[model samples]
Target: MIFILIVTLLIYAGLVFYVAWSGYRGIGIKGNRWFLIAYSIIMLFLSVSFILARFGSGSTLLAVIGNYWLALFSLSLMILPLVHLIMLILRLTSLHREKTRVAAARIAFVVLVAALAYGSYMAYTPKVNTYTIDIDKSYPEDLNVVMFSDTHFGYLSGKKHAERLVKEVNELEPDLIIIPGDIIDDDLEIVEKKQIFNILGGLEARLGVYGSLGNHDKFRGELSELITAIETANIEILYDETVTIEGGLALIGRKDYSEGERLATEQLTSQLDQSLPIILLDHQPYEYDEAEQAGVDLVVSGHTHRGQVMPGNLITNRLFENDWGYLKKGQLHTIVSSGYGFWGPPIRIGTQSEIVQIHINFNN
Candidate 1:
């Protein structure tokens, strides 16, 4: 994992440098020393700002600038490549190379800005995605399960975001609310500083709020402390634990995959009555067949964020069987949320922040 991260950073740094140089040259401003210097400085700062923020710089200004710069940087990388391709195609025409470069550069800038604008709007707007599924098992009444993941409640998803989640979730009048994982961002202290827990405590659902520890949540604090904090907020944070809700169905929450060796799905469900419906919450979506074989009726997950941004989702789609949305294998139903909040940059392209609403209709 460390090696992969290092290689990814190197590749990212190289692409960023190439884009910075290409953009500067494309604008036909090579002769303006002052302009070049100013541009270089800004690019350099933006490039390293995220690293600074991640390393505990503890500056909101740096966090804002760095995170937003990441979004802009991603857009630039995507748009600049297409712009270059367009310019290359235009070389066949009568247009001069320099003029085409300048035109392409301007077009790229406009498109980048527009893409960022769209992505930012989508990121802030949380949508309720409803899914209705029929279960063969019999229950007294239908269950309205409202689930969302990856809130990352730090600088990006603070008070306002929590309030939005509570308000929207309550308005739905769900019987249950499930946060698969990633309730906190990277820092646990930020939750207290922002009074995010107080706001999240406002969440109203009949079954109450329940969540499992995500990979990000694992990094925030000690397992016991994090679980206590979440439970104190009226959320039940399960760790390799199973509970019988209303003595009707069983819900199992597993430790994250990064937690070394967690319990297997079949092992966790072995003791539970096979007749009762079973739901599992595993942060990262993996080993679907195991869940299905274990007689798990449903599984919820939220790690991928469905590529959170354009082209990023394209990669995630290939990595997981069901990166986002619902997938059923045999009798098991899996729903992977794209996430309610973002990671590095508070922006999402080709995807929107979502809360999943699964209306389970059991056979009478």
Candidate 2:
């Protein structure tokens, strides 16, 4: 973990320095010492603020600023590259280098700001994505399963966010609610102090709200405290357990992959009645073949966040077989949500926060 953090920091520092150099060149470095100094100070401050946040510095404002800056930095990484390419083409064509460079710099800055603003808006506005699937097994009626994952409820997602989510899910009138993981941010103090868990209790679902633990969900204080908090919210936390809902529909929730030595999917489903349809909830989207082999009708997950930012999804797409949407693998179906909240930065570029409402139609 320490090694990965160091490598990530190195890569981030390298990219930031490259972007800074490109910006300086784009603006034709002459008399730009002050600009360079200012930019350097801002980047340094943001970097330090982010590090402080990781170490529990406890300044919400600093953390928010740092995260927003991280989003802007990521946006710059994508937008500035194209600007540099344009500048290169203009320079090669001998089209007044100084003027082209300055224009490119101005355009890049404007584009970066616009992208950041748009992404921030996308992050806050939660969209409901509805998917209807036909189950090949017998059941009484259609099951309205509403799910949202990665609601890291701490500094970024506070009481208001929780309330909003509750209102939205209640409005959906779901028969069952499944939270695939990451109910809390890495800390439990803020969530408990603010009574965010109680606010989550407002969520009204007929079959009750159920959740599976994710990597982030396990990062905080006592596991018992987290479970108690979730239970207090009238939500059941399923840890490698199976429960048959009222209609004989079996719901299996697995411990997150980060939890170490979890029950195998096949082992979990070995003695289950397969004719009634089995739905499995696993936080991270991995090992699809195991779920398929285990006769899991549908698997829901959310750890990928579909990269949570632009080009990040491209990486996630390559990493997971089905990163964002629904995929049919033989007899099993999997749906991975982009998630309802942000992780590091409260920004969503090339992606939007979503609540997945799946309609399961059972054919007898």
Candidate 3:
């Protein structure tokens, strides 16, 4: 773990320096000493944040400040490319000479900053995306399932955020609510924060609230507190286990993807009654094939966050067959959310923050 942290810090520091270098090049170094000084100061803060955040600052205030530093650094990375693009366009069109090209670069910087600000606001405001599916078999009436993922509670959101989530889910009148994974941030201390457990416990679902662990949930390697928090919030944690709700629907929760076969999908479903509709909550969206072949009807996931930001989304799009939103295959269906909250950057660009409302109707 120490080695990984060291490597991460080095990479982050490199990124910070590169962003500063990009700004230097874009703005031209000829008479920009003040600009360079300002950039250097910013880089210093970002570097400090990298160390403090990665190495573990015991102070909550430092953590929050570090998040803002990371956000600014992230915005700079996006702005660099845009600045370059603007410079190139201006030079290509010859609409502006050298002076004009420089001005256009600044314009690009403003545009990206404005976009980052708007994206940050949207990151906190999760929208509800509803889906309705019909099963060919007969059963009790319809089941309203509200599923969300990637809350990253401590990192980007906390009590007030969870409170809003609870209110929103309740308003949807969901029969069941499942947080596929990533209910916690990378920090385990979030479980102790009054706001988190307090508001989460207030969540209302007709059947109940259920959760599966995500990579973030195990960040500290101690699950007891988080588990206790979940239980306190009236949420059942499906740790590589299955539960039947209302004696009709089967919900299976798989641990985070990295756990590597904590419970093989085949073994997990071999004894199940295939006639009943099964909902698999696999954190990483990886077990879809196993679920589909095992007679699992649907899979809900949220690890990808649909890339959360751009080019990143482009990579996630290629990584997962269904990186975000919904995908259907024969009798099997999958819905992957972009995530309710964000991680690292605290902004959502090229994707939406969402809560999923899936209305499942049984065919008689």
Candidate 4:
């Protein structure tokens, strides 16, 4: 964890510095003293935000402010390199360069603002993606399963968001609902302040709404309360356990990797009737072979958030075999959600926030 923080700080700090230097050089020519003062103030704000947000007393509001600031700043960094490239070329060619640099800077700012605006809207507009899969099994009915992960009902969203989600899910009239984790981002204070738990209690599922833990749910060392809160909302935490739903299929929910894995996939599935179809709810895509070998029919997971933001999605795709969608290998199938909510930045660039609707049919 510390290593990750260190790396993030280092990288963000480097980007901040690069932005500062570029601004001083390019935009400074417009005005000297006022530009320097404004530049220093913005840098100070960003620096203070990073320091207090990470090392201070963990305020949700501060965290929220820091998140959007960092997000906008991060996206701005993407365009900075292009501006730098253009400036470099102008320097080399040395012909009408000042006007060109100013023009490039103006265009980049407009592009940055436009991108951020679009990303902001996309972040909140959660969409439902549908999938139809036929599992080879003899059963009496078709199972409509609604699965979503990373609701993250804390800072970016609140009780209204919870209510909206329940309404959306209930409208689908699902037999079962599965969540793969990250129901809340961090800090129970925000959860309590927003009454997110009570709002979430509104969720209704015929078979029951089942879920597993995610890293952020345990991030602030508040797993116990989060669990209590979830149970209070009538959402069952599966936590390395299995429950047979509607008398036909086994639903296995695994512990988040943050928590130690208590049982192997085989052990979890070993006691179940082999003839029945088995589905797994794991917060992350872990031990695929173990689940597949154990005769698990489908493994549902989220946590990659389909990279949540761009370029990051590229990294996520490389990290997981099925990072953002459905994949089938032999008899085992996997479905990963991009998630229904945003973390940190509350922005989705070149990615989406989504819920999965799976219509599963059994041959019998």
Q: State which candidate has the highest TM-score.
A: 1
lDDT of 2 by residue, 235-274 (tens): 8988999988888988899999987899999988985887
User: Any idea what lDDT model 4 has?
Assistant: 0.82
Cα lDDT listed for each candidate: 0.88, 0.86, 0.81, 0.82
Q: Backbone collision count in every prediction?
A: 0, 0, 0, 0
How well does candidate 2 score on lDDT at residue 315? 98
Cα deviation in Å at residue 290, candidate 3? 1.0
Give candidate 1's whole-model lDDT.
0.88
* C-alpha TM-score for every candidate: 0.94, 0.91, 0.88, 0.92
CA error at residue 78 for candidate 3, angstroms: 2.6
lDDT, candidate 4, 1-45, per-residue tens: 999999997987787888777666656365578877888897768
How would you encode candidate 1's per-residue C-alpha lDDT over 151-183 as one tens digit per residue? 999887889989999999999998998888999
By lDDT, who's the top model here?
1
Full-model lDDT, candidate 3: 0.81
Model 2 lDDT on a 0 to 1 scale = 0.86
- The list of candidate 2 runs beyond 4 A from truth reads 1-7, 22-39, 93-96
Cα lDDT of model 3 by residue, 1-364, tens digit: 9999899879977887887776666576667778778878866876687458757754666677777777777777877766667666767774747677567667767876797788788898889999988776556878889999989888458777888898998999888999899887777665465468777888888889998999878656567767877678788999999988885788888878887758877766765777888888988988577778888888999999888877788899899999988888878889999999888777888787899999888885
**What's model 1's TM-score?**
0.94
Candidate 3, which ten residues in sequence have the lowest lDDT sum? 50-59
Give the residue spans of candidate 4 off by over 4 A. Answer: 1-8, 29-38, 48-51, 90-95, 219-222
